[model samples]
Target: MTQYIGRFAPSPSGPLHFGSLMAALGSYFQAKSQQGQWLVRVEDLDPPREQLGAADSILRTLENYQLHWDGNVVYQSHRHDLYQTQIEQWLSSGEAYYCQCTRKQIKAMGGFYNGHCKPLNHQDPAGCAVRLHIDQPVTEFTDLKHGQITLPQALAEEDFIIKRRDGLYAYNLAVVLDDIDQGVTEVVRGADLIEPTGRQMSLYHQLKQPTVSYLHLPLALDENGNKLSKQNHAPAIDELDTQATLLRAMDCLGFAIEPSLKDGTIEEIIQWGVQHWSISQLPESTEITPRFSNGSV
Candidate 1:
């Protein structure tokens, strides 16, 4: 069997914290153990949230942690032309339509676009966006960790927007395009993304693209039980203790790591970890906030 190809795509909204390490290490080891090529891509498509010095700092942090990736880094911001081409293609094929619905209107309509603009013959004026037409999404798929998951009837039937009304390509569109372009055979990331995977899979069917395997690892949450995100003010990982941090992340993934190796080198420890990497040991599918093992140590 051919080896898998996986990627860790982090947005430069803020520097990586321990939560980020969990996803990176999880995906990294999965790819490495399978003799697959692991790649890194900067999801800088969302410009407003992007930090000025964060991208370079992020690369530096990855280097410090020895989470090196293969090949040239794919920057989403630099690929706007490709996105525009696809968006225009979808529009021309009548697969997408123009929408001018404001957030306030959607809020008043009980959330989600009520297809208010779906029948509009109006052209996309400046600042307007396009939305993909969706039929009742009754599609079912299997997830690697969470087992046979089923989406709600209402959620499956919602006509999702592919391009945002803000003149920016929506996440669903970009993620599908990027993954398709990169030939991604496997998607290993945090479980917070599990909900979106079904929608992306739908788009794959629409575009006639191959679907990739998904493994959504347990999310790293904060004291508030919210996922540790840069937006939630999760402090960046302490680069000075990258190896220790990686070890702690491993523990969060449900490994009974030995104490003697807690302070070992990142590579040395990761090699040992790959030998013991057992996906079956992961906790039940639920939100989990990561806690550095002061107790485990």
Candidate 2:
């Protein structure tokens, strides 16, 4: 049997908030439960949006919470050559083409790219983004947690961009490539990314690689009902009280920590979690506002 491999990829846009921690811990527990390898990757692909020192801070925070990974952390910024190589191959094989269309033009065309540049065959790489030509788009995929999910026809059929006009590799491109390179067997993250699963699966098909399994946890919402995210100014996890924070995250994942282990150490809590983790116990909803003991998330 092949060893199960999972990862927790975090972007260096800000510190890990409660929602982010839920993803990290969920991935960690899932991996450890199966006695598999759990890896860490810093998705610092977009340097302009990345906060300085945020990557290191994320690693340190993981350590504080005792979420040790199996190998050295992989940074997306260091793997530009790998992405460029794939793009070059796609271009040469006519699987991808350069698009000169701007965001305004795409918006005018029903907000979804209509594959206008494929026939144009724009050669100049200057001021042009590269888009993969989707011959057979994946409209639906079975999520480990959510079951069969069908995507909108336009979204599933759109010739999505692999490289941006600003010379940055798109998230869908980098994430799929990185997951393949790392030999990741499963992707355990938040449901906020559930929409991109089909696109990523399409990339896997394009690359002729088997797609990994996906387990998307429920999205943690804030007081105002928005996702608890850095973009929303969500507060960072309180490192001073790692025990309480870990328990809260576990609760969000549907783990009812036994009273015998409620006051356990961080390592003890993680061990108990791994031994008792069950995907079926997870809440069925995609978005949920977590409830805690003290009326605080």
> Which candidate tops TM-score?
2
lDDT on C-alpha atoms for all candidate structures: 0.80, 0.92
TM-score of each: 0.93, 0.98
Output the TM-score of candidate 2.
0.98
Q: What lDDT, from 0 to 1, does candidate 1 have?
A: 0.80
lDDT of 2 by residue, 1-297 (tens): 999999999999998889999999999989999999999999999988888989999999999888999989999999999999999999999999999999899999999999899999888899999999998899998888889998888899999999999999999999999999999999999999989998999999999999899999999998679999999888888888889889888988999878876679999988888999999989999988877666554
- RMSD (CA, Å), candidate 2 to true, equals 1.0
User: How do the residues 10-94 of candidate 1 rate in per-residue lDDT, one tens digit apiece?
Assistant: 9999888777888888898888888889899998877888889888888888888787899998988888888889878977887
